[model samples]
Target: MNLLNMDAENRVVLNVGGIRHETYKATLKKIPATRLSRLTEALANYDPVLNEYFFDRHPGVFAQVLNYYRTGKLHYPTDVCGPLFEEELEFWGLDANQVEPCCWMTYTQGRGKFGRVSVTRRGAHVTATYGDMPGAHRFEWVNPNS
Candidate 1:
């Protein structure tokens, strides 16, 4: 079994999903995998707040993004997802064909831009807002200087 010491504010683990991934800084881990799953399932099932943040989005994409926060990496960027997956490729409705792909990043995070990727649920499309920009979104794919 994997060991996770979540005995403090920020929990840390030496392995996850048997992947053995490490974190930049070790945290006091407390929540075990089962507890984490229970919490996640409960949050996903009952959190209207999260729904407002990403309501009507694909479950898979939402899960992927959530996984990013957990693992500190985003495996599915627009460029990556575009070439790797076609429309109707993923079980969730996170189609890379809906719009352009985009990527962005902050100081702590590394860069892997993939352009703007958007998807529609019913009649409206998930959009991003930038100050006076035509469409400022999260996945804008800003290339970092080498």
Candidate 2:
């Protein structure tokens, strides 16, 4: 998600639901310039209208997830970016690697890292969970007409 913030060191804040989800940033460093340039070239041709609000310095990470969301595409080659996701897994480092085909949202309230929140899918929508919370929510891809 695109956000406005003053960045420093290894951190950024995601503004979700009006509250700043102030937390650490997992943005990749040391992006290999050559491969990134190729990805950029391929991306410009695809975006006829330039609508994606890319949050990465280059589109590698965002593009990986967006294509997964947009057209159910996967394994689009992260040759230079393989290290990026590995970096994210560093904190998830000790935690047991849960089976994939799951949804997880992790954030923080203060100094502590909140573990990934559980998620469930219902039809075309997704629901995230916080244990024992009274209310639960899901966001369906909005289609004015189905």
Candidate 3:
């Protein structure tokens, strides 16, 4: 149904980056000034084949963003890269500060003539150490520019 005639309690189907999500219209309208809220308001009619509003976005990240709307809590997902997650949150008009501390960790091991470099993270902080050089280390985060 079109938004003009949609029921307040009706569930809306969203095909977000090929992933399907069914949420209450009221829930989707909870956050004003957000893309989701604007999308809900712009729902002129549902697609015939998909029968949902289609949006081009990373489906994986959208799941976490959806949860924020559903629960009023935001958790940085470990599966998604921090930089990418931050960009998605920005697009969704979400505050990055809502993220819980140390909610994610990433690891990268590099091996070469220099032996090996091990890197790990706790939230935005990253600690790196080299196997060849004793006590060799450095710390960094995803959003260095910001």
Output the number of the TM-score-best candidate: 3
Ranking by lDDT: 3, 1, 2
- TM-scores, one per candidate: 0.21, 0.21, 0.59
Error at 100, model 1, angstroms: 19
Error of 3 at 6 (Å): 8.1
Best by lDDT: 3
Off by over 4 Å in 1: 1-54, 77-146
Better of 2 and 3 by TM-score: 3
Better of 1 and 3 by TM-score: 3
Which 10 consecutive residues of model 3 have the lowest summed lDDT?
104-113
How many clashes show up in model 1?
19
Clash statistics: count for each candidate: 19, 0, 0
Q: What lDDT tens digits, residue by residue, belong to model 2 across residues 44-104?
A: 3233253221222333433443233234333323333334443433322211132123322
Model 3 TM-score on a 0 to 1 scale: 0.59
Report the candidate with higher lDDT, 2 versus 3: 3
For the record, the alpha-carbon RMSD of candidate 3 to the native fold, in angstroms, is: 11.2
